[model samples]
Target: MSANCSWRSSCGRAVWRSSRSSSCSSRRPGAARPGRTDLASVPNGQAPVLPRTTRLFQGRVHAASITHIKPPSVRAAVPRRPAPEPEPSGAEPPLVATDRLRKTYRSGDLETEALRGVDLAIRQGERVAIMGPSGCGKTTLLNCLSGLEDPTSGTVRIQGTDLYALGDRERTRFRARMMGFVFQSFNLLPVLTAAENVELPLLVTGVRSRSAREQALEALRLVGLSERAEHTPAELSGGEQQRVAIARSLVHDPPIVWADEPTGNLDSENSQDIMALIERLNAETQKTFVIVTHDPDIAGRCHRTIRMASGQVVPEPVTPRAKGRARAAEAKR
Candidate 1:
């Protein structure tokens, strides 16, 4: 029996020879000592057995974890939308009101109601004509609207500012700054030249003479009378004088132009010419016009016509000319 054998390998089983003397007491046949392999064989016929295998040299095993992550990608910044477009500079504002504007006149004991609650609105750049027979308040309405006469009742406004609230001096200044007048009669001065007649309004406003003359010439040029600038109104024809009058009205570049029978005294040929000129100015310059006339032909030429009868505005059917003009404009569009 080898007592000092190392327990190194799996086969390091203890081997023991039975004691040489059978009398050697208490000795097992294959019993191993402590810190050594078990080699004991039972005397009651027990056989040697091996111990079971276990995880002695193996390292610890951990559960695997799974996590989700997103990858980076290319992105662009979105552009902001542009703001909505603004209204045009010379455009008319929408109608705010059409009130009962009236007027009354008393001649000694006889009373005349020139207007019976006339409800109307004159927007910026609106071309409107006042048409009717005599005593229809056409001129009276024009006078009130142009701030030349005060209304008996009701109100009139320009861009929401009441015209009647202004004092006489203030009203005069306002008229010079905001209105242009064209009378039925050729109101030109016989003494002043065409340019000088055109410069009257500016002169009244106290503009410098040189500047007034310059503006007057330009206005005459617009009416195609630049060649006749030095000629007096008496020297010019009826049409030319009317053009000079128009030039005078335009000298101040007022927003509104009030024509009280501008062509009432002119023949048809000259009347057509004047209407054509007015139409051109309305289309090109976008100036507001309120023309008074007794001619349906003249009224037809305007964008809108309000017919008056016995001091009251009466509704009328649209003329063929207006229909034709509307259709032509549509076709052009």
Candidate 2:
């Protein structure tokens, strides 16, 4: 064999032949040695025998070519999944909703119906006024809707959660957390100062005294009653007392405020001032308001009015000016 003649083994490792001999030698089997081959070591007309473990080119074997093995293909019988239901479009769930709400008061054989299948929806941030003549169930509706009183039949939902579904204690706790109430009577304690009155809600909810005091002061400041925080309800004027009551209602930052004749006890100027303050609060905080009032002026100032009579909602015609104002408000939003 010529000294330059060489060939690679089937294992891909280089097998070299000595210049003086035809036999091939490798440093180790299966080790690569570039620029070397074992072709020269093969006898004239015969191929060299390689180790049994060696693999040939194209997956072949020296004695006989081995067939390529493949795994059988499988098709799983997977059921097609059903498509998802489409979500509602542009339809916001009501912040407050009542369905066929009814309230009946009974005394011995005498029974008085306060609400009769009143279905209503109040959107978030809406200033809604409920107005009607005396014996119209306005106060009863407010009480039922605020979770303060139980409805005779049907559902009251706040923020999509059914208020009446909760137990009495749970409902009370939920109201403390989710609602604020402003009454015409200005229900502040006689002994507690304005700040203490404002902080009462927080204390009931287990807030620390110092923190509650700070929050109370802040709430008072919001209502421009910071200077009067130290004054008791007795020392405060009627208007100032009402302002204190407003502060107390808002101190906890509830999302919904139920005002039942908030300005009923105030003079005309004071009533205007209170309504202005309420409007400012609604504009600033976006808190939803459900005000029960007989005053058309107050009702007109609200974004919408709901009139009730004989325990049923009476549909009122929308004036062009009111429609224009509503459109303008919606456009601004």
| TM-score for each model | 0.69, 0.73
Per-residue CA lDDT of candidate 2, range 73-95, in tens? 22345899899988888768889
* Model 2 CA RMSD to the hidden true structure, in angstroms: 14.6
Candidate 2 ranges beyond 4 A from true positions: 1-88
Residue pairs of candidate 2 with colliding backbone atoms: 6-39, 7-37, 7-38, 7-39
Candidate 1 per-residue C-alpha lDDT over 5-114 given as tens digits, one digit per residue, 9 for 90 to 100: 22243355343221223334445676543323244332223333322111222443222232321212223457999998987886555322235888988899998899
Instruction: Tell me how candidate 1 scores on lDDT.
Output: 0.77
Clashes of each: 4, 4
**Candidate 1 lowest-lDDT run of ten:** 65-74
